[model samples]
Target: MLRFIRLIIYAIFSFAPLASAAQDAQLRRLDTIDDNRGWEAVGRLDVDGRGFCTGALIAPNLVLTAAHCLFDTDSKARIDHEKIEFLAGWRNGRATAYRWIKRAVVHPEYVYDGEVGAERVRNDVALLELHHPIRNTTVRPFDTNTRPREGAAVGVVSYARGRSDAPSLQEICHVMARQQGALVMSCDVDFGSSGAPIFSFVGGEPQIVSVVSAKATVNGQQVALGTQLEVPLEILRAELAAGNGYGSTAAGRVVAGSARRADGAKFIKP
Candidate 1:
C-alpha cells in the first residue's frame, strides 16, 4: 500500500536533520528478532561460496521469501538451484527438519532495484517449491486474515547477516500508514532481512500480514517497509489451484515465454 511509500518520502526529508552517533547505535540496538518459537527458519542460498539471503517455510512444502533477496540480478535474475536450502525450526546449530529446493517461483510482477526505490520495493515477496513436502506439523501456511490497527504491537523473526543459528526478535511499530500495496511498520531491518515476515494478532491468531519490502526511516525512526499480503495471498491461491505442489503436476515451471517483471521491478517494466 502507499502508506509505507508516503513514509519513505517523509523519511527522505524529515530525517535529514541530524542527531548523535549514540542515538544511531541505540536505534540499531532496537533491531532485534523475537524469541524462536512458533516460528521456524529456512537457510541461506549463495553463489559460488559467498553468502546470499535467507528464506523461511510458510507452508507444507512452500518456502516464502523476498524476490530480490534470493534472485541474482547481475546474471539474468534466475533462482539458482544449487544455492538453496531449508532448515526448519533451526536453532543453536540444530535443525528440526531440512529440505532441498524443488523449484523457485518469483512473483510475476516482482522487480529488483539495486538501491531503495519506492515502487520497485512494493512487490518484494516470492515463494519456493521444496523437493519433498514438509509435514504440516513442522511448518504451515501463515494465516493471512489478520490486520493491524494504526498503532499496534508486532514482532519479526529472521536469520540476519547470513547467520544460521542466531535468529532474533525485536519490538516493532504498528502500521504507520497503509498504501494500495504497502504498509509501513516501525521495525529495524537491514539488507539481509528482506522478505522476513511481519506478524500481528488478528482475531486472536498470529498471522503474517506483510513481507519486508524496503528499509526506510519514518518520523526519524528506521522501519522496514512491507508489502501487504492481500495480493500475494491471491497469487498463492492461484498457484494452489494450478497444482504447484510437492505432489501436484504443475511442474513448478512458469510457461517459457510468460516470465514478466512483477509490479515493482527496479529496472523491468511493471
Candidate 2:
C-alpha cells in the first residue's frame, strides 16, 4: 500500500511542470496597432540599422529603453548617437512617427561587461533624447510611475524576434517577485524585446513602472526580468541634463552581455 502511494505522488508532480509551460505559451502577438493607440508610444530603437531594441517615449523628446541596447555586441563599443533612430508605432513596415536620436544616456552605475545580477539589471535602464520631439497627436509619450508591489498586475508591449515587424501587447502578466530593485515577472518576452516598457494600470491609464532587461527561467517556469525605473530614471535624466552621461568610443569599452538561452530561456536583446 505504501509503495502504491509513492508511485501516485510522483505521477502528480510530473504533470505540474507541464501546467507551467502551458501558461507561458498563452502570450499573443498584436498584429495591428490600429486599436492600440496608447501602445503607439512604444517603438523600436534601431541601432545603426544593425540591430534593434524596444523603447518607449517618456517625454516629448526623451525615450526610455535598456542601457545594453546602446552598445555593439561585436565591437563592445558605444555606437554613435547619430546611428540610432526611433520608430514610433511601428507596424507592418509603417511607422506613425520616425525620429533620429540626438543623444543618449545610460545609468552611471551600469557596467556593460558586468555579469547579470541584481545590481547590474537594476541599473540597466537608459534614456535617449530625440533630435526632434514627436509632436503628433497619435504618438503621445507615456508617463513614468513608481514601481508596483509584488503580485501586482502589469502588462508589456514589445517587438520581438519572430514578430519583429509588428509589436505585441501582453495585457495580463503579474509581478512574481520584487527584490533589490529588480522585478521578476511572468510576462512573455523574447529577443528584440529588451528595453520594453512594463506598465501598471493601477489608477487608470497605464504608467511605466519598469523596463525589460532580460528573460530567464526560474525553477521550471520562464519569466521576464525588469529594472525598477523610479530611481535609475531620475539619475539618468539628471546625468543627461548635466551632459555627463553620453557614450564614448574610447578603447577598452565593455561589450554588452549576450542573451543566455541555454536553459530554455533567452535574454531579449541583440
Candidate 3:
C-alpha cells in the first residue's frame, strides 16, 4: 500500500530544531489571519478550564482535528462528547454558535504513545460529529492531491495557550522529506497548538494538507510534524456519509485550502 507522511505537527515550539526571509515574512502574516478564520475549540477532559485542542469545520457537521488531541495515551479513552463542543470562529471564549459533539470518530489505526515515540504518533487524525449544522459559513476542505515542494512558503492557523484571542501564523519550513512517509515544515508551535491545521498555497488558494500532531527534534534541533490529511479522507468520507438525521439542516458554501507550498510563495488569493 502507498504510505502517507505520519508525523502530525503541533502548536508548541521545542528547543531542538535549529533554524528564513522577507518572502517568509509575508506568508507569516497570511497564516495569522487564516488561523483566526479557520480554528474551532474542542473541549475535553484533560484540558484545563479553557479547553485545549483545536479543530476546523470541514463539512456542515464534521470537524477535523488530531485524534490524539482528544484522547488519553494509555487508556485510549475518548474525551466526554457532552463536554466536547465546537466553538465556531472561536476567539475569547465566544462563537457565533456552539455545537455539542454527538460522537468523535478516531482513525481505527491510530495508536498513541504517551505523547512520545514515532509509530503511534504517526496516525493522528480525528472527526467530530456536531449536533447541529453550521450556519452561513463557508467551510474549507483539505486538498490531498498536492504537496508543498522543498523551500516552498507555508503557513499554519491554530489556537495556542498564550495566544487565545485569535489564531497566530508565521512563516515556517518549506516542505522537507525525501519520500512519501513524512513532510516537514519550519513553523514553531506549542502544546495547545496540537490539532492546528497546516496549509500551503495551491492554485493560488490556501488548502489544508494535514493537521498538527507531534513535536520532535532532528540532530538536537526542534521541529514539529503533522499527519497528512489524505490519511483520513477516505475514512472521513464514510463517516460523514453515514448521516443519521444529524447536522446539515441548511445549505452552505464550500472553500478549499491546504498546508502545501504555492508555486512561488505568494499570499493566498481571496
Candidate 4:
C-alpha cells in the first residue's frame, strides 16, 4: 500500500542531479492556455465543491475521469451528481465552458475499498454526462485510442495540488511497463492528477490511451499508474447507456467526507 508514492517528490530527492534536471526540462506548466491550443479539452473537475480532479472532454456532453472522483473519500458514498461541475479548459481562474454534471458512470468492477493494486488501478475509470454539451469551437473533445505498447512515448496534461490553478504538460514520458491492464509510466504526477488523461501521439494527433489512477515506485523510481482504457471504457459507456451505473445518494451508509492518507496523495480506490 505504501509502495506507491506520487512522483512529485522526485523533484527533491529521488533522482541524480542530471536526471532531475532532464525531468524538470520536460515537465512544463501550461500557464496561459492561449499558448497551448491543443490542450484546451482537458479541464478541472470540482467534485461537490470539496475536492478537485482532472478530466478531459471525450464528447459533446461526456467527460472522462477517474471513478473515485465521484465518491466521497471519507464516506465512501456516491457524491450528489448536482454538486459536481466541469470547468472545461480551466486556467487562471477562467474557463472556456462551465457545466454541471447530470449523471456519472463508473466501471462495474470498480470498488472503493481504499486499496492500491494493479486490479484496483486498472478499473479506475469513470465518465460524467454534463447537463449541457460544450460546443465551443476552441474546446473540442479529445479522441480516444487503444493502449500503446510498452516503452512507447506518452504525455500527460494535469492540474495538481500546488499547480491547481493551471494545467501542466509533461510532453515527454515513456511507458515503463504494462501489466494486468495497467500501464506504468515515467510521468510526473501528484495528488490532484488522478483522472488526468495519458495521451499517445498517433498521426501527429493526441489521443487519450489511459487515465491516471495512482502513482507508484517502479525499480526505485517514481512512476504514474494508469488504467488501460480499451475494455474498461467500453464497459463504462455501456453502463451509462443502460442508465444503470449512477451511484445512489441514499443516506444509510457511513459517509466519510474525503479519504486522505498520511502521504499527500489520496487513497487509491477499487
Candidate 4, residue 110: CA error in Å?
Answer: 0.2
- The residue-by-residue lDDT of candidate 3 on 1-270, one tens digit each, is 001222222212232232321134322322333454543332211131224666776666677777766664446675555455565565443454556676677776676544433334446777777766776443444444455555566667665655544456653545443123344556666656677777776676567776777555554444557665665656766765675312333322212441211111111000
Model 4 worst lDDT window (10 residues): 261-270
Better of 1 and 2 by lDDT: 2
lDDT of 2 by residue, 119-185 (tens): 7778989998887788999888899989987777888999888777778888878887777787778
List pairs with backbone clashes in candidate 4: 73-259, 74-256, 74-257, 74-258, 74-259, 75-255, 75-256
Candidate 4 stretches with Cα past 4 Å from truth are 1-25, 247-270
Model 4 — TM-score against the truth? 0.83
Instruction: Give the per-residue Cα lDDT of candidate 4 at 13.
Output: 27
All models: lDDT?
A: 0.56, 0.76, 0.52, 0.77
- TM-scores for all predictions: 0.69, 0.82, 0.67, 0.83
Report the Cα lDDT for candidate 2.
0.76
Poorly placed runs, candidate 1 (over 4 Å): 1-35, 41-49, 114-117, 136-141, 162-164, 243-270
- In angstroms, give how far residue 230 of model 4 lies from its true place: 0.5
Clash counts for all predictions: 17, 0, 36, 7
Candidate 3, residue 224: lDDT: 55
